[model samples]
Target: MYLNSTSPTPESCEAVYPDLASAIRCVREQWCELHGYTEPFCRNGVWWVFPPNGVIPVCIRDVMNSDKGQWVRIGRVSVAILPDGSFAIAPKSTSDRTD
Candidate 1:
């Protein structure tokens, strides 16, 4: 479910994952399809995509700083869209931490 002027949601939208790992797997698969590259995974509780041309980080920082709720958990994993039109995955619990 894209909130506004953004990219399309990943495939398997209705199929729910039982855990964060499964959710990340689904996100990664979808991201790979969209970007034509291997998807990056969460590192140290944060997922980030560094574009080759120096794009801003596409982490949840954008949405988290927006009008949306300070913390959002999609299914079981925390998510963010990078500036390069990539996706970031984080632990659902980290949404509470100060940005």
Candidate 2:
């Protein structure tokens, strides 16, 4: 899946996966590893928030992290992977603690 983000460059980047299920698995695992977040059975046509500053797809955490596209955090933030093999995010509060 790809999410447009302004990082090293303002360009649309993608996290390559064998398939959608693989992509979801990476994201869900990141959620749990980051803070032990439990993911529900992902439903179709739903936006799954990866969260602001949260690593997405999580397949490239070591290489890159938190690559949210387009959407920015106003105060609080969240990211969601749409059913279209794409990603979306919204401004919402998360339990993520700042250090």
Candidate 3:
């Protein structure tokens, strides 16, 4: 979500959702609108969208959560948007380290 009046990458930031399905829907809708894509599919640990009439799927965002909060990938870093709207750099998982 928008961090404040001056924050850049506002559209690329994360927001809270009530459940996993809602979070996935939010990402799919936003990514499709911004990039003119139609379909969303997940492979590996990343979520991707198909370009209109194109073959390759583009990685748009990753939606995840833990006991801490909701996590999303922003550029090269994964960040947690806590329930209170604070931010934190999420600790890397084993899968992240290999990537």
Best by lDDT: 3
Weakest ten-residue segment in model 2 by summed lDDT: 69-78
| Total residue pair clashes for candidate 2 | 6
Candidate 1 vs candidate 2: which has greater lDDT?
A: 1
* Winner on lDDT (1 vs 3): 3
Query: Alpha-carbon error at 3 in model 2, in Å?
Result: 12
Report the lDDT tens digits of candidate 3 across residue range 1-99.
322334334344455455545554554465466547767766775666677788977665432232243355545554544322334454566887854
Better of 2 and 3 by TM-score: 3
List lDDT for all candidates, in order. 0.43, 0.40, 0.50
Give each model a TM-score.
0.33, 0.31, 0.39
- Model 2: per-residue Cα lDDT over 7-97, one tens digit each: 3212222344455566555554554445433333344544344434555532223323454432222223323443233564544456664
> Can you write out model 1's per-residue Cα lDDT over 1-99, one digit (the tens) per residue?
323344334432445556655554554445444544343545566665543344554543332332321122457544454322344454457768887
What residue pairs clash in candidate 2, if any at all? Answer: 48-80, 48-81, 49-79, 49-80, 50-79, 51-79
How far off is residue 74 in model 1, in Å? Answer: 9.8
Residue 2, candidate 2: alpha-carbon lDDT = 31
Candidate 1 yields a Cα-based lDDT of: 0.43
Quality of model 2 by C-alpha lDDT = 0.40
Q: Compare the candidates by TM-score and give the number of the best one.
A: 3
